[model samples]
Target chain A: MLIYDLFKMALRSLIANTMRTFLTALGMIIGVASVISMISIGEGARQQTLSTISKFGTNIITVKPGRKKTRHVSSDSVQTLLLSDADAIEEHVSLIIGAAAQVYRPAQLKFGNKNTNTTVRGTGRKYAKLANFTLDSGRYFTKEEIISARRVAVIGATVVKNLFPDINPIGQELKVDGNNYLVIGITEAKGALSWYDPDDQIFIPVTTAQKRLFGMSYVQSIDIQADKIEDLEQIKKEIDTFLRIRHGIREGEESDFHVQNSSQWLNSWGDAAKTFTYLLGGIAGISLLVGGIGIMNIMLVSITERTREIGIRIAIGAKKSEIMEQFLIESVLISFIGGGIGIMLGILISRTVSEIGGWETIVSTQSILLAFGFSVAVGIFFGFYPARKAANLNPIDALRYE
Target chain B: MGQLYLNLSSESVMIEVKELSKTYQLGKVDVHAMVDVTFRIDAGEFVAVMGPSGSGKSTLMNLLGCLDLPSSGSYFLEKFDIRSLSPNQLAEVRNKRIGFVFQNFNLLPRASALENVELPLLYGRIQNSHQIARDSLERVGLADRAMHRPNELSGGERQRVAIARAIVNNPAIVLADEPTGNLDTRTGDEIMNVFSSLNDEGATIILVTHERDVASRARRIIQMKDGRMHQDILNEGLIA
Candidate 1:
């Protein structure tokens, strides 16, 4: 028989029972829609994370003091990083743009009667450039202030809002640990960095903080900036070697400090996001397999129902290939129609989720095409057995079927 | 008796059967449906096989129509040996040469009268199927009811649609198995009248019936019993 005639027959048979056809197609529709929507959400989240990481300075590196162990079996080791180590790194590393040593402590800031407990950071002027900090008002302390150990401070926007609400905070006097200090600047409102709220802290000179509040000459960590991102590894090695020599570490012993680049942290985050998305897509793909099985079941029932019709066509001279082709075409048409509907529904679902859940969603053209092609493949793969069964039926016995 | 020719000439028989038998394996037992049945039917002969239930009349018709294979036989249809043809080749022979009319009319319920008549032509390699199907329906006096489905037509009208479908491909023979078994006596008579006109136009026809009046419509009657032929009689007088 001609292909057109077979197609016409298939279409007529499907149209004769519209409700059953629609119900069968609905399974595939839901399967494709869920897969597309979940993948879109995952892709959107991954892109957002990468963009956020890139916004931070890519050439920045941080060094922290490692836990010290006592050689003489003492319970505690008093080994601490100091300002001299920061000086050593600045003098020795060729690729280092600037370095700043920091000492952090919690203190209460009192301006007149209003007081708020906030974290205090003690560092030099170079700390502002290394950490990508910008001032919104006034200016940071000059080199003269650091050398003289002047009691000058730079407040964050959140600290100014809480302690000096309605008052100009620049050049105002604020008491810290019972000592009076003048606030010289206010930093810009920078949102959370690494889960720490950068907008709620105060900055002061490391020399003055160590002399007055901390009463120690030691620092907790050092921040460094590289002139070019490509020189970051060389700069870290130079700093490690300088620190090891300054602390008198032997060749075969582990160092008491660790150097970490921003790229390492970003890589960890990116890897976690990729795994999450793959897991989501894998779970959704199982539903697609189930949907394909549903299609196969319905097609088997259809073949059984039309056994006599198949016999009549075969008796009238239809070839086996022609019979197979007719059934294959019917299955493909069903899945194609279902896939088209699924794409429309998936887009709508993604939009709804983005609006309601406040999650970012991006639907790519490639994903839509991939989903449609997969649905077609599923139809052919799952529809093959039933089509073969229909094609191989004996005409004499089929005609005699009740 | 007519002279039977062995060569493929004008005088050769269109269908020749010799010692044809069919046995069905019913579970563990084998039932002989047609035992050593022999017959020859020439072109343009209106013949009937008459018998009671379980008398192998339908079995004989099935073998003649190429719908079933015989257990042991040498049956020649035209010039080809029926036993030697494959299933697909047999289907082709049935499509191009033989037309069948079943007792229940066997009209596809979902199709219109015109589409039903167009079915056999669709199976054939014929162009202009619509025109030929319309002409066949006109021949059966159902031109006005061409668009009505089987359920919408009366019993006499449905039987006429079946006749139209049977002759639509212009096959060499028309085989009817109890063509009027489900219809009333009057409708059955009307269907027989349609067969009479079709045979008058030189189409060979074979019918299976148990009624004496129905068998008398044919020019020859072969009576069967216990899977074997009992008598062969000629009707010297034709029914009007």
Candidate 2:
């Protein structure tokens, strides 16, 4: 028989048992949807992390005090890093444009009747150039302000929203750590870096934060910038070598501090995100496998139920391969339709997640095609056995079947 | 149409079988279904092979229909020796040269009468099947019931639709096994009349049944007893 005729015949049979057909296809629908949505979520998170890393400037390296792998990793216990180390790196490392050290501590702020707890980041004037933090209003604190330990602050967008909703945050006096400081500047919104909201921090002079607020402390982290993008790895190696010598760690002994470049941070994050994506996709893939098994089971039952019809077809001269093709086509049609519906459902779910759940999700065309192609392959792979069974039936026995 | 099945020496013969035997294993013991049965059917002959149940008549029908291969046999459809043909070739012969009408009609319950008739033509690679199916349905006196499924038609009408499907491919033979067994006396007689008319138009038909009355309608009767043929004769004395 012609392929067109075979397709029509298979369609007619599938339509005969509407409920069974629907239930069988539903398995595939759910399987593909979960897979698509899970993959989209993973892709969205990876892209968000990558963009954030880029936004912070890829050439920058962060130096944190102490060996982080040791039990004592908290900055309160690690006092090996200092402002002198930052100055030494800038003087010795020729590739470095700026090596800025910062004292970071979370503190409470009060403005009139309103109050909010946010991070206090204390850094030098070059932090603006090094960290790529652009200003929205007032200028960054100058060198004179750092030397005098002036109690002046730059507020981020989130701090402004929470502490001063209506009034201009810049030029306003805000109490930081129970000490009133003039808010001299407001920075543009940097959005979220994963779970950390970058716009929720208040920037202050490093000397003021160390002497007045977080007293008697070595800086928490050193933020360094390379003169050119190509000099990043070279700068990181120089800082590692210099820090090891300055901290007096011998050869083969672990250094007292870690010098981490931006891309390394991205790579670690990327690895974790990749694992998460695979885990989600794998769980969803199990359900899709179940769906293919469902198709196989239904195809077997359908073939057995339609034995007489097959017999009639065989009697009238349908070849064994033709009978096989018809049943296989029916299964493929089921999965193909299910795959289509799943794609639409996946897209809908992805959009709803980003809109309602506020979760990041991106459905790539590659992922859509993969899910669709997998469903098709599943149908064919599972559909073959039962169809072959149908094709192998003896016409006489089938005709005589009740 | 191009005399593809013809041989000048035996141009009149449509089917020839020799020393045909079939054995089935009923559990462990062998059951001889047919024993050295042999028959020849010329073109345009209306013949019936009559026997009681389990007397090997149905086995003969199955073998003749090419639905089952014999344990040992040389069966020929026109000039093509079926023993030499491949399984695919056998399917082709069944599609293009032979037709079947079952006792239960065996019409696909989901399809219309026209679709049922179009089935053999489809397998035969006949073009313009919709028109041809309609023509075949009209020939079976089912012109108005072309769109009706088998359940919508009466028993005799259903059998007539089966006959239309049987002849739709213009086969060399039409095999009907107990074609009127499911119908009433009147319906059965009507079905037999349709067969007689088809035979009058020079169509070869072989009807299998236990009923002497049904076999009486055929121009020739071949009787079977046990697993062997008892009689092969014309309706020379039975007519009128």
Candidate 3:
């Protein structure tokens, strides 16, 4: 009736049938191992996504002029956002640390015999650091050049690679829409993102583009740099209110401009990653459930096989609860052993995945403990019915069993 | 091992049963396995209950061993009424005051001879069970085979180990069912001799057997037939 004696008997019986014990525990091992590896892999992917998103300067907020509310019947709006609005945001919004007002147009570039169509963005000197872009060589145009509407441009690597294959692009003459502009600098090469490629565009003074090239008095977009990442929301709120009042957009109506923050983009992608993580955990949990059912199946068979032995034990003086405890301990021990082995295997797999497969995998102790605890619970939960059946067995009937 | 109060002037009863009956429901009809079985066993008495197959001898043994609940009975082990006791209390009675030996030896096959003997004492919550088991094994003349598993031992040795287990807790009654049914004549006689010696040592024993030869060794015999007691006689005359 003592727990120690019951455990000893259970251990001896399990040892008597080593093959069955190991086979029963195999299900739990695979179940727990998958749970661990799946969660760790999911966590690693989420962290990777966060770091990749962080690379684009999450603090930067963009404002695009919306033509949806335009009453123009010319098929296109004449001007919705002016450069004065950009100056107002820079001067009035205290949370706005810096602003880059830009106008964009796709232009055909000409240099010697090579010509290619590329995006030409007009912006001030502050656009480089605010947009997290760097100059590969040469220098940015002076502030005086933008004030004087000088014909200067900063070419991108894709433009330079296509337009000047044999010649250095900086300080060279490049014709933009039949207007000659001196290339002041060459921007760094940036790979493509989900939205667009920065390396395929050229930068010019906004004044020059607005007065001479596009012949427009309005800016296309304004990229606002927050004082800090956390201040973007406040800056956006202040800008929204300021823009709404300045544009005479009534309350409760859609504004003629849209303020976009990196937080929204990160949250969308974060939600998807979180859903994927939960799905992986759920699928892995199903295996654990299957493992638990396998344990119960084997435990039932074991109880049936040991009917005579149980009869003998009951005859010798073991109580019903003692019998139940004996079998429950056997199952719990099986799962605990399997869980221990599974933790090791899962850690090994995660390390292999990270080291060899080059996919980041974080093996957290919390995840291991959670999976281990779940396996234990599975064991106890599934072990109950078979154990109770064993306990409730009539000793006389069991003794006479063949 | 704690105390003893014996009245030499009067008889000390170990087990008392009256109006005991057991019925089994076999699908639709109720089969009466034991019908009004009534008997009394004295302390230190060696009694054999003999019956033909299907005569309810095993059922009677199971009831006497506290392994089954009778359908209607006022059975008593010492002062405690067996029918009134809870299952847990019945288990305690079996642990502290009764021991059982089965025809198949019923030793856990994977365990050693010593472990088999230690089982009853372990359930009895006896301290120093290993040493007690070792001493029990020695009493059965299997001291050298203490570490040997049941499969490694001969049939006679396994039965000897079972006897050691039965007496390890020093119970007032030891119930053995067909102790030598599977053995040859010589080995059966040897097993019967062990039982006789255990009786000589003042251990009350109730043995179930169909063999007249095995039954004759006991100091008393109770014969059963058709789920009823046919005869109850003392074999003290033959022993004398």
Q: Which model scores highest in TM-score?
A: 2
Interface RMSD of each: 2.2, 0.9, 1.4
lDDT tens digits, residue span B56-118, model 3:
898898888888888996677785677777899899888878878889888887789998888
Off by over 4 Å in 1: A57-61, A70-246, B1-13, B17-19, B36-38, B60-70, B74-78, B81-97, B119-129, B200-202, B220-224, B228-236
Off by over 4 Å in 2: A67-77, A227-231, A245-254, B1-8, B238-240
Query: Sort by lDDT, best first: what order?
Result: 2, 3, 1
Comparison by lDDT, 1 against 3, better one: 3
Q: Cα lDDT of all candidates, in order?
A: 0.83, 0.89, 0.87
Q: What TM-score does prediction 2 earn?
A: 0.93
What TM-score does each of the candidates earn?
Answer: 0.80, 0.93, 0.87
lDDT score, candidate 2, position B89: 86
Question: Least accurate stretch of 10 residues (summed lDDT) in model 1 chain B?
Answer: B1-10
lDDT tens digits, residue span B1-240, model 2? 223343436679988887899999999999998999888899999999998888899999888888888899777788787767778888898898888999988999999999999988877778999999999888889999999999999999999999999988888999999999999999999999999999999999999998989999898999998889889989875564
Model 3 CA lDDT for position A28: 89
For model 3, state the Cα shift of residue A263 in Å: 1.5
**Pairing residues by index, what is the TM-score of model 3?**
0.87
* Rank by TM-score (best first): 2, 3, 1
Q: Write candidate 3's Cα lDDT for A96-170 as tens digits.
A: 678889998999999988899999989987888787788999888888998999999998888888998988888
Give the worst 10-residue stretch by lDDT in candidate 2 chain A: A68-77
Supply candidate 2's per-residue lDDT for B7: 49
